[model samples]
Target: MHAEGADAADDARAALLAATGAATLDDAVIIARGRPRLDGGEPAGPVWKVRSTRGLDQEVSRLAKSRGVSKSQILREAAAAYVEAS
Candidate 1:
């Protein structure tokens, strides 16, 4: 009876792994966030969050749309520009 229970538990575990698309416990544990890199390079560094007014948020969105880039890209370029100006 003990051996039968162990086999049933093993079967349940295999079914769970199949359902979650993870082959092992380690594969099921990892959590990755953010956009994946297209260059096959390392992921981006730490994230920076900023609070913005509604007007400023709209302006940044407009600028980003005009330049065909993401708001994050715009922010990065703006930071570089500030460093250069300083």
Candidate 2:
């Protein structure tokens, strides 16, 4: 059972790395951790919570890293664009 669980975890990790196009397991782990929040200063607005699927979250992480921006920034832009389109 333990070996099976370990194998499952390994498979999941591999899938995540592949989906995110990370070069290695360590890269995948770093992507999963995400960038640290900036210190000090109040937020511009009220905080809001968002939930997403694992696949979507991974893709967002990759996009944010490639663009040198925070995940929140990406989500905010996307939301603003959606509202504008609507």
In lDDT terms, which candidate is top? Answer: 2
Model 1: runs farther than 4 Å from truth?
1-40
* Model 2 Cα lDDT, one tens digit per residue, 1-86: 69999999989988978865677777777666765553455455667897899999999988986765578989988988999999
**Which whole-number lDDT from 0 to 100 does residue 74 have in model 2?**
91
Residue 34 error, candidate 2, Å: 13
- lDDT per residue for candidate 1 within 8-84, as digits (tens), equals 98897776556544557444333112334634887667789999999988899887655544678778888889999
Poorly placed runs, candidate 2 (over 4 Å): 1-43
How much RMSD separates candidate 2 from the native structure? 8.7
Q: lDDT of each structure?
A: 0.67, 0.78
